[model samples]
Target chain A: MAAAFTAIGGKWKLTLLYWLAHGESHFAGLRRRGAPITPKVLAEQLRELEADGLVERVVTGPVPARVIYRLTPYGATVLPVVEGVRVWGEAHLQRTDGQSVSDTAMSCASSIV
Target chain B: MAAAFTAIGGKWKLTLLYWLAHGESHFAGLRRRGAPITPKVLAEQLRELEADGLVERVVTGPVPARVIYRLTPYGATVLPVVEGVRVWGEAHLQRTDGQSVSDTAMSCASSIV
Candidate 1:
């Protein structure tokens, strides 16, 4: 359990996975979707996810390279857990603050199985 | 999402919650169930959980005193997420290491809704 947490426990990693699972695969797409994560931090977290075998990085083209990240099969297995977090967070926000879960948050929660 | 992770992201917090959800509510029971977490660390994590409104601490009896920890209604919402983690971890262990998820691990995953 601890090992699993260490692999995907970053503040932005799960959110990144949430976006990727919804078809945001390219680097720029992920960065734009993950707005609060600065470019440097996003790069670092992606590197960590790649190292942990949860994400695969692909490079294409000649002069200007395009990099894309996709979940490994192993990584896809984490979607349920991410959904769990999203569900819990939505309930938590509603319970504690009397506010509806945000559209982005709801989308992330509803995107996976 | 980031705030949610910060509240429950400790290595032992979710595992501790798993035990509590299964009815091991006393401090000593939690300690025994959470074998990998040292007493000091358990105390620290429990403190954090209490502060986050996920746990409630109760003291009963006159002589010797008994302290029990249980999930708040708010805290109970997180059980599904923990279940999700347990499922993912079991599948992850099997896929990567060709081994079953430990008994303790499965119980943690199974105890909650």
Candidate 2:
């Protein structure tokens, strides 16, 4: 359980992975997707995920290069878990009063299952 | 996503719920199950879970009353999510070098589904 939590335990790790499930995103794109996450924390979480082999960071172009983040093939293995969390979150939000995943991520997560 | 994480997020909420899935336990018992959790944090987490309606605290006896913590019927709703985390953790542990859930919780969690 700790391992699972460690891999995706933080507030933003799963959310980041959820966003990546749609396709790769540049650092700014991901930052925009989860607007509340600070750049420092986002970079840290992305680094941790990359270390865990669930996310990969790629550099595109030369100077003023764009950094892309995407799920690795090994990372794909965690999609089911991500979907479970997303679906549960959506349902819980409906039951209680809370913010929810965006429609795009919601539909994409549902379809992935 | 925020709602779901709020309900069972944190390092210990899901684990607390996972232990309770076996049966109700008192403060000491819960402490024993999760040895590393500080008393203050355990109380706080239990209080939060109770406040969220996922866990219930029953007082048995008077004078040095026994406090038993158990999952509310609604709390059972989060079991699938907990199970997903546990199963994923187990698999991730096998693949990586990480701690695994105790045999008791592992077998019980497996039997739950």
TM-score of 1: 0.66
Q: Who wins the TM-score comparison? A: 2
lDDT, candidate 1, A61-81, per-residue tens: 553437778888878878878
Off by over 4 Å in 2: A1-4, A63-65, A100-111, B1-4, B34-36, B63-65, B100-111
Clashing pairs in 1: none
lDDT of 2 by residue, A1-113 (tens): 33345677665777777778879988888766535668888899899889888999888777554778889998888888877866776676677754544544323334345
Residue-wise lDDT of candidate 1 within B6-101, one digit each (tens)? 466665777777777766377777766535668888899899889878999988756453888889887887877877776676556555763334
lDDT of 2 at B44: 93
lDDT tens digits by residue: candidate 2, B1-113: 33445667655776777788879988988766534679998899899889878899998877564779999998898888878877876677668755554544333234344
lDDT, model 1, position B105: 41
* lDDT scores of the candidates, listed in order: 0.68, 0.72
Each candidate structure's TM-score, on Cα atoms with residue i matched to residue i, is: 0.66, 0.78
Best model per lDDT: 2
